[model samples]
Structures are given as structure tokens and as C-alpha cells.
Target: MEYTVVENSGYDREKDVFSHTSYWEAFSYRARHYTDSEIREMHVEIAIDLPDGTRTYEI
Candidate 1:
């Protein structure tokens, strides 16, 4: 999975996340187990092709 990473400040100034549907859904579930600082410092973007179109998510 691949996505573009960007900083966002619209909603509480959180880092914006982008990825494929499958990766995003899985990441969402997995993120629940991580601490705030961990997620904040973690990098979750890559460059690759996916079946479905890319998506944007707010952390």
C-alpha cells in the first residue's frame, strides 16, 4: 500500500493520513492499540499501486 503524507491543521491540527481502503481500514484498527505519541511519531506512508483509489483520513 502507498499514500501521500501531509500535515493538517483544520481539525485540531492533527497529521493527515492517506492510503488505500484495505490499508486504511487495517491501519485504523491497528492504531487503536497504539499510544498517542507512538502514532504521532510513526510514519505510515509509502509509494505503490493499489486496486481501489487512495483515500484521505484525519488522525
Candidate 2:
């Protein structure tokens, strides 16, 4: 599976930024920049690619 870390730090949906290729890498990036509370408030998520389809969940 592949993973992507999305930063939803703005109001413009089209301008959301994302990065990373693995869950651990993505989690590390988020951990460095945001506290657990901030992450929940910002709606940060990790998008995962599976054989079935892409899925997302709060980080």
C-alpha cells in the first residue's frame, strides 16, 4: 500500500498540500509540525491506496 499525508491548513479546498510515500514518514512529518490536538482540529489525514481502492482516515 501507498500512503500520502495531506495538510488541510487552508480554506481553499483546491489548494490543500500533501506529501510522503509511507505511513511512518507521513506520521513523522505531522508529528514534527503539529500537536495531537492540532492535528484533530485541522482534519489531517493519511490517504492509503489498497487493492480495492483509496481510503482516508484521521491521523
Candidate 3:
């Protein structure tokens, strides 16, 4: 799965702005039983927040 920084990309709730939804949105509502391997097989990348406040992980 690939991620890009596009202008006007997906909504940022913390910023209170409405924007385009990314491909990941399709999987947002899935059950917790869904595994990372399953998601990867589905071409979805998981985003994680690192200890560094300025960093965001996309994998």
C-alpha cells in the first residue's frame, strides 16, 4: 500500500477541517478481529503515531 501527501487530502478531525477521504477509509469500519496480515493482503496500510509528536507511521 502506498500513501501520499496530496493537497486537500482526507479530513483532519483534530484540525476541524473537512477534506477528501483516503483509500484507508474503506477499512475504517471493519471489526477488531481483522488482522494486520489480512489488511495488508487487502492493500491497506496502517498508520501509527510514534513517540515523537511530529511523526506519523504509514505501513
Best prediction by TM-score: 2
TM-score of 2: 0.58
Sort the predicted structures by TM-score, highest score first.
2, 1, 3
Per-residue alpha-carbon lDDT of candidate 1 for residues 1-59, written as tens digits (9 for 90 to 100) = 45434333234454545545465654564465455675465543323334486444442
The global C-alpha lDDT for each of the candidates, from Candidate 1 onward, is: 0.45, 0.63, 0.34
**lDDT per residue, candidate 3, 6-28, as tens digits?**
22223343221111245354244
All candidates: TM-score: 0.28, 0.58, 0.23
Candidate 2 colliding pairs: none
The TM-score obtained by model 3 is 0.23
Give the lDDT of residue 58 in candidate 2: 38
Off by over 4 Å in 1: 1-27, 45-49, 52-59
Worst 10-residue lDDT window, candidate 2: 9-18
Write down the lDDT that model 1 would get. 0.45
As a whole number from 0 to 100, the lDDT of residue 36 in candidate 2 is: 90
User: Which candidate do you rate higher for lDDT, 2 or 3?
Assistant: 2
